[model samples]
Target: MVVEGAGPSCGLIDGFGRHVTYLRLSVTDRCDLRCVYCMSEDMSFRSRRDILTLEELTRLARLFIARGIDKLRITGGEPLVRPGILDLFAALSEPIADGSLRELTLTTNGTQLARFAEDLARAGVRRINVSLDTLDPERFRALTRGGSLARVMDGIAAARAAGLTVKLNVVALKDGTEHEIHDLIAFAHAREMALSLIETMPLGDVGVDRVDQYLPLDSLRRQIAGRWTLHDVPMRSGGPARYARVAETGGLIEFITPHTHNFCADCNRVRVTASGTLHTCLGQDDATDLKAHLRTSATDDVIVRLIDQALGRKPKGHDFILRRGASPQLARHMSETGG
Candidate 1:
């Protein structure tokens, strides 16, 4: 019982009336590095049939754009690990060139970016955010298990050179390497890259023993001790973050805290997983299986209806961490959920 274009331009609308115009697409469930925080030693992956093909993704994205989805972030276990990524980017970028999409970006582990940064830039990728949990070489090696710190650093430089707005993402952990926080901020300032410190979410396959390491953002902010000015910057056109800025050194730094910040107040994003399920909230367990719905009813009207129904279920805020004792109930790992 979905209408084609009834809801406010955007494909979905939550009860709060926020136009969900942003979509995160997962192209693959494969990643090269086994980040200890993301996957465990005994982790296994989804079957090939569980992933959506590039063609299917392009079609779904086109549908989303038609419904006012102007921003897209191509995510994955690591998007670059998939073959013909440039080709996929080409297919996904057409809307951006024609003005159907306002922005196109990607988040990666940066291990494979050195090989494709320029190509991705040429393919209409305007921004790139890379996950770098720690700056120490040995810690990086231990955390990622099989990634080279030097290679990731080189990739960041290459992305900047290619005219891509490079963002450095770090997951602030209590036990691992909190001492490197200032050093990382300094590094990003020197390189003129926007940096983000994320609180560790509990949805990944990583062992739950380190749940205590999930440092609440307020403590991290206090640890910085007014080294830089934190402006009340509003969320801009791009879907990077809602609040931020680092005045002293020039580059911006955002504290991404799904558990601490709870941006759901102004949330405008809906995630479409690689398996074709639509999630209203990133931390919520509720989801609608769009693939099954599409198979039986491929009409745009029906799809929009399904999206609306999902959005209606979107929570006002994520209290899972606070209520569930810092552990998310959904068992799906981060890679599988397109984080």
Candidate 2:
């Protein structure tokens, strides 16, 4: 049911005047591959009882759409790894058919894309972001802790064949995978796919030193500009990625610099974990227990009130820093929060 006082004019406008229109809802924190940067080798995932059921997730999506969320991205440790995830995608597509939701997308590790790409496309997913750090088989396996590079590559091809617009998400690691940046860009551009290079954020203890892994995008951009003719483009893909057109490959490249550059001023997104924890800020621990409210059989009005209260507490920006011996800003990993 649509909230009575919710719409474009009276939607979720935070204190900083940033209107929230995007929701990144994580279906599960369980991933097939344990990437070195995202999670520890022996990660402990959330229990099944704690996660929101398919029915609950569908209801939450409806509530968010009623409150003027036009774009919804299904995220997770790996969204595709979540069982019955396609059903959720199919259910969320209802809003799209009714003109209430503008887009439905997801970010995946591409491990399962080869098997589910067609189903996802049929369920109204037009685009997807695949996390691929390196093209070399050995390096890819090392980064993903035994993930098959060939399998991911096949998944990308399958996604393309299934008529999904694929974007490669590359996490820039200092002294790690930097050597393959050019090849990755070439590979993505050749397939008419956009490549996003992200600076690794200190989110969880993956047994690796973040200080040694951190690579600022500002410096990387300069290095990239030296080789390719880059012209800044005023394009945004709903998240914090800033885009630029590479004149050499006639393709697009995105710089997701969370540390060196703060893209929070225009932040229009909120994340909900698999367990239904609503996070207003990625770097802040100020969150509302939405699952508690949901499990209590609260009325829609009461839930809406809780959501409004959370929005009122949204901070102006996040406090993400990268330094030697500096602990993670938040104990929850990006996987736990929603990738």
Candidate 3:
């Protein structure tokens, strides 16, 4: 499927016969919360000088769009905490409004969403994924180390009011989560938001052993099936998640099973960190530093060549179980990689 002379096909085809179409662009590594499972409270933050500018991100995104990327998910260490970020959203929307891009979305902690949900919708973002682990305020505070669950609730409501389709992501853990899972599904149903259960992966040195929290997808799905029938929902995007519909509440559920690599067969995304590094795989240490290559002097063809090389080497499956070490292989925190 390659062009007559170019290294790869014009459709952004990878060597594995998968077309990469989704880009998860990180705006900043700085976060507003210190979640125990995501980041350590004493974690050192990167200086603003090392982060990518909004202009650089937008430029790189346009090149990706031309390379067959149709969806962009602006992620971060709570991207809303990044100053002047609404401007980036407005900038990315130009492609969407003009039909060059199919979708533009974001993932946030929802702590600051109450401030910009409507503004973001007006800026051309129609979907958002808010990270919510628990429903109880006390437990939420304990997990996030002082984050206000009330603020997240208000933010979800505000996004809905602004006509944005909202999805809630819950980090599933092995122990003491039976009741919380039920409550989370109920909460999503009440708000008409889809909920996705993400298995806690061994991503960073979050100061806790992941084996203690690594909840299996089967166990969680079995728990949900005990209450409501889950009918499968097929989405066009060949992303990592597989969705299901909850018949009783008319809600949707997505399972992010990196642990089992259930969705790896059709994985179709690459992530760009805030520091302008291209990560072809989320759980792998492989990365291509694109900051220098993406300078003003670099042509679009040059950028595409670099991207083709990266996508060609994209790992087919995440190394979740085959790891030979006790510590996390990926030293960067999830915040630094945009979750």
Candidate 4:
């Protein structure tokens, strides 16, 4: 089902000329931990009936692969929590096993990775990003509300032990303590893994005043630049994060600054929620509901056309900017957005 072209429009090119080749698929919105930055303590999740079936998920992913999406990422409230997720993994891995999809990756909280790491490695998942904002047990519990830092640490160790290319993700808030930031850098250096520092996006309740929490990553970058001689790494993935290696530690750090840097101009990825809604840009609310189309008599070609219709009109970029009293928000939260 290749789109029958070798140009920008061959896959998922927008009017702005950015060739989209990455897909982030949210398998479910049910998370075991209520991270303070991601959701409210009493948040409600979608019912099981609303989620896409395993077959539906596979069909949608296959169509995207045909359209030239070489890299596919699995995300969720915490992707490992979904039952029958291994089946879905096996189904999605078929193309990769045969050399159709270039890479299949995942992003998770790491709380569940300890048990799933071996299975994930065996299922053809080669790379993963684990979210850990702090290393202190009390701080971890405070941020995630009952999440065990030890469990997440165990998960991290298991992921590495299973031979997975593990990367750590951290949300650097404006009010973060210097000790935690430095310690996290040290931790990554110890493991010899890349650490991606992400600035908080004003999405969902996350149970905090996002404006108060928002931090410009430039300062953090300067702070690290002062300590270590950093070397720039070339960008191969269309994802927005910028990379550099610490000359002293051989540890890498990628900064994904959506509000501060706004990579939307050159963004080359789109997202699909667990229930089959497609969002062309993370900073914009523009989305098309594809569940109805998939559940009906719609053909793959028709689905492809609908995707074209959505990407063709992709917004120039997200409009929300951080400022005093700014209350930037989206209709859907991080849970639904698949992070």
lDDT of the candidates, in the order given: 0.78, 0.88, 0.84, 0.85
C-alpha-based local distance difference test score of model 2: 0.88
Error of 1 at 160 (Å): 1.3
Consecutive 10-residue window with the lowest summed lDDT within model 2: 1-10
Per-residue C-alpha lDDT of model 3 across residues 62-123, encoded as one tens digit per residue = 77887778889999888998889988988888889988799999999998878999999998
Q: What TM-score would candidate 2 get against the native?
A: 0.97
Quote each prediction's TM-score. Answer: 0.91, 0.97, 0.94, 0.94
Best by TM-score: 2
Q: What lDDT does candidate 3 reach at residue 66?
A: 71
In candidate 3, position 18 carries an lDDT of: 86
After superposition, the stretches of candidate 1 with alpha carbons farther than 4 Å from their true spots are 1-11, 229-242, 295-299, 322-328
Tens digits of per-residue lDDT, candidate 2, 246-266, equal 998899999998898888888
Q: Model 2 off-target regions past 4 Å?
A: 2-9
Which numbered prediction scores highest in lDDT against the true structure?
Answer: 2
Query: Per-residue lDDT tens digits of candidate 1, residues 1-339?
Result: 233565335455689887778899988777888887777767787787877777667877887777778888999889999887788899877888888788899999998888999999988998888999888888899888878999998888888888999888888888654678778888888988888888777776476554666677788787775566767576564333555667777677787777656566777787888889887777778788877765566566777677768888887766545343444556787787786
Ranked by TM-score from best down, the candidates are 2, 4, 3, 1
Q: What is the lDDT of residue 30 in candidate 2?
A: 89
